[model samples]
Target: MARVTVEDCVLKVPNRFDLVLLAAQRAREISSGGALTVDRDNDKNPVVSLREIAEETVGVEILRESVVQSLQKHVEVDEPEEDDFDNLSLDVVGELSAMVVADTDEDLLTIQDEPDSGPIETEE
Candidate 1:
């Protein structure tokens, strides 16, 4: 209780690297005004965090999630479902292509009748 050792905390967190990461994250939380799960006993943030881990006062899963969230720069979002607009656009393109084919026949006839004239310009 008076002194916190890595051996005590290792029982709760098996990996030394993971234990360091979680302890560091918890210490940061303490500095940022997060509530402590164990008695501080006038100890600093890191010591308090280690004590909490040793005593199993806080949930390891919750701490692990928090650490992962804090470290992540980008948050993934679910893509929107296919909508009516996509289908509508495809239908519009089909209609436009049909119209173009019909117009081409008339255009060929106009060009043959007026061979001397320049190309016909149609306004949309």
Candidate 2:
């Protein structure tokens, strides 16, 4: 896991064709890794090997299309809504971002408090 930093929250990604393809490949790698190593200070630097990435299950096209689709859908620039202000809180957005990329039900559940282990006992 990487330390959080302001630049991570705001950086312009190159949307050029070759760069987009490269990024999609990288995304696929991260998505399929046993775990990812991140270094925020190093430009949210990700250290993933192409060989390790190739071992991942995702087809390259699927990875590319998913990335392209998400970019196309949200290309418009807009003012942040009031609810967004709330939703964008460091805790909420950060947690939600984690949820978006979680690969396992167990990983997602780990973020939450344990639900009543088996309902609560009532006091008389």
Candidate 3:
């Protein structure tokens, strides 16, 4: 389980997967159905209210800490170079190669700029 500690709030998340799932779900719910209100006078911003969710869920705190620790561990390791892609799957390798070949600027015109394609624009 991971732990997220923010101020006096201590959340103990049961597992790594649950941490991401719960955070995402809570965030989505809050984003779609308005943010949760915390009755604390000290909390002013909407983001602060969101933090209350973590404070309420002890398990989530633990999971958050674990995620942070895992991220830190990865940060300490030296990143691999492009040459490390030798063993990658063919499909993934092909996709990676496509990044250099793809033309992202393909004729994507805005609606305002588009010629009146709906009906003829005759003189008034």
Candidate 4:
């Protein structure tokens, strides 16, 4: 109990940085009313989290995943199924491919959004 918990935790979680993250995440969970796997022993939340990690009472992989989930700003959602894909194919092939009809009997008319103007000099 007197020994440094970080040293014991390093044996279970090799990376010191990841160990810190996992320990911090676990400590936050404890602060948020998560059940403790080990005795409080008058220790703080961080120390209790380290003790749990060192004793292998909590799964390190689960802690790692939870930390990742907590840090993610955007969670990916499952894509919709392909049930409506047939309708999309039909629309693209038939409806979308039709040409616009004009008042005159021209095959295709040029639709200009803006009038043509001479090039102007810039004050570079």
TM-score per candidate, chains pooled: 0.65, 0.25, 0.28, 0.63
**Cα lDDT of model 1 by residue, 30-79, tens digit:** 99999988878899999999999999998889899999999999999776
Tens digit of per-residue lDDT, candidate 4, span 20-98: 9999999999999999999998999999999999999999999989998999999887867574697788877775456
- Per-residue lDDT of model 3, residues 37-102, tens digit only: 444455433334336555663245543664466457445557576545664666687897786455
Which model scores highest in lDDT?
1
The residue-by-residue lDDT of candidate 2 on 5-121, one tens digit each, is 323222322344443464445645565653443322333212332322233433445556666765585567786697677866977889988887775667768767567578688
lDDT scores in order: 0.91, 0.49, 0.50, 0.86
The alpha-carbon lDDT assigned to residue 24 of candidate 4 equals: 97
The pairs that clash in candidate 4 are none
Q: What TM-score does structure 4 among the candidates reach?
A: 0.63
RMSD (Å) per prediction: 8.5, 26.8, 21.8, 13.4
- Range of the 10 consecutive residues with the lowest summed lDDT in candidate 3: 1-10
The model with the greater lDDT, 2 or 4, is: 4
Summed over model 4, clashes come to 0
The deviation in Å at residue 67 for candidate 2 is: 1.5
Query: How do the candidates rank by TM-score, highest first?
Result: 1, 4, 3, 2
Cα shift from native, residue 115, model 1 (Å): 18
- Which one is best on TM-score? 1
The superposed Cα distance between candidate 2 and the true structure at residue 119, in angstroms, equals: 92
Superposed by TM-score, candidate 3 places the C-alpha of residue 5 at a distance from the truth, in angstroms, of: 5.7
